[model samples]
Target: MNEQYPVLPGAEPFYAENGPAGVLLVHGFTGTPHSMRPLAEAYAKAGYTVCLPRLKGHGTHYEDMERTTFRDWIDSVEEGYEWLKERCGTIFVTGLSMGGTLTLYMAERYPSIRGIVLINPAIDIPAIRAGLAAGDELPRYLDSIGSDLKNPDVKELAYEKTPTASLLQLARLMEQVKGELERVACPILIFVSNEDHVVPPENADIIFRGVRSSDKEIVRLKNSYHVATLDHDQPLVIERSLRFFAKHSK
Candidate 1:
């Protein structure tokens, strides 16, 4: 994939060393590390080793995203997770949107994951089905779904156009993931926005019901939108996540 557009300044991957416990932060589809930076920094400051890797085809031009598949994104996260595993005593995974979906998949596959935090995880989206129904008749890309923050001032560094192929792959991956929730035996903390524009709030219920984790917790965001990590209630996401980690990642 060609880098038609230059990567944004703060959107680059972020890493910091601190405590023995490692935290892997993953960004969503079409999003850069910028969206997850605040939480990563918070974890870093709290004395945890944090690694935020830019997903393949993301943080670059929209055209390049079409060249990638869902596996590519997951591969990126897996690589970062392996890097953290070597250095950290315990590893926790957290992500937003598609990132959250990937986090769940990782937890299911990697029993080594100590815990996970998900923000508006995209287990299902009607738009993906609609695009699939349209098939080849649909355009190569669609309008942006970024910056769905309740706080008007905050904006996510995401693609202006959504890649159709990538979205299709995302849907397929979610279908596979939703069925394997029982495999996620680790502690999980999920934050969902009641007014999410992109992911239906009921997706959270589906996940809560599906996951076998006895320590699973779901926190609803009354004032935020889809991108709750960068919204008005962002601090709550960070604060609650820290507490959850402390409680479960011992």
Candidate 2:
């Protein structure tokens, strides 16, 4: 049964505690934390605390995700953030795709966040809205959005099909986050993939123009796709992310 779907191997959330500076790593929609695990491990090796939370219906069957709303996923990230708050003195958030949407939501509400790092964050996917506007009923499932990595040997542990119901929630979440982009006052580092297939590089530009942060900058990822965390430039991601964290940390 979908309700009893097991958590797939390597899809479990990642958590490690060390120094007073903490980080929350978030995976994209339909993606498990496995893609973010490598980054989490690097943070742990550097002696910083790390928390990667699995979304409410993710890391399970697509049928399970069909039953969830965007708010449910936000709740999951909220729990992870609160857990870090109790154990660390300063906190930064980093996310991929939809995870980046939630990171913006948090940064808007909590100006206390030291900063945020987003890799190809999915925002305002026109296809989703265009389909709905045309009044075409979307199929229950669509082609997968996973594993958009430039590295041929790497594969992301994500759902093979996307639930159309969840796309609605995602659209709503993006709209809400986009409306409040001006509220993100913390330092921001956004990664843009020049040849991303999943999320257009324009998202990086939109976020760059929207936020009011003085310390914001965009890093172009030349060798990766949407899921840059596991792509060819993964090391550059880890190195730049660590640098961003250090710059914002007190």
Candidate 3:
């Protein structure tokens, strides 16, 4: 199993500092903590405790993703939240794509969160549904598929095979979370792309309308795809997130 599932390096034992505010960074679906590591390290360097936990079934075998559910992903975020809550007076959640969805869900469920930063959040699965309807489904376990983990400027990083079952479950979770969006009262900063091929750009509008947070802002990235965290807008993402943290961490 170990040979079939070669562990991705640089992700292990979550790290952080005991402080007044904590920043939690989460990566997208079928992605490892490495996706969020740069931002995590940036936050840490700025003197805030940062937690970048590997989501359930990710950073391991793709077979493990098939065996996991959306609830399992949420549980992992909750675990990270609890860990951050212990050493910090305020907690801020941030994520990319599915990680963004998890961050929204966390804000809705836990009012203690001081603020939120969402990067190309995936709040719907219409494309996945369309693929299912077309009967073009992918495999449940594609552990051997190679990743596009290279230069973001020249190439896009994504899973070779998107699991149908997992995507279906994610759709359901999004629907449930949408209903609770109005319950979130903290400040929210959303980063979206004008040309994200994977997640529809309309999701930004949906999130903006659903969220009850009065202190909310959306920044559009004109030269990026869905994974803006690793795309050309990465520097902007880091800077904006750090600014948000500084504003609310006090």
Clash count of each predicted structure = 0, 0, 0
Task: Report model 3's TM-score to 2 decimal places.
Answer: 0.89
Q: Residue 168 error for model 3, in Å?
A: 1.5
Across 168-220, the per-residue lDDT of candidate 1 in tens digits comes to 88998899899898999899999999998888988888999999899888999
Candidate 3: pairs in clash = none
List the lowest-lDDT window of 10 residues for candidate 1. Answer: 1-10
Which digits, one per residue and each the tens of the lDDT, describe model 3 over residues 1-250? 1224555665443667956789888888877787777788788888888888888877765666767789998988988888888888889999888889999999999998999999878887686667556554455543322232223444333345656677776787788888898998899999998887667888888998999999999999876777777667788989998999898876
Residue 51 in model 2: shift from native, Å? 0.5
* Alpha-carbon TM-score of each model against the true structure: 0.97, 0.97, 0.89
Q: Rate the local accuracy (lDDT) of all candidates.
A: 0.90, 0.91, 0.79
Q: Rank the candidates by TM-score, best first.
A: 2, 1, 3
lDDT tens string, model 2, 100-145?
9999999998888999999999778998888666655678788899
Q: Compute the lDDT of residue 184 as modeled in candidate 2.
A: 91
Name model 1 segments beyond 4 Å from true.
1-5
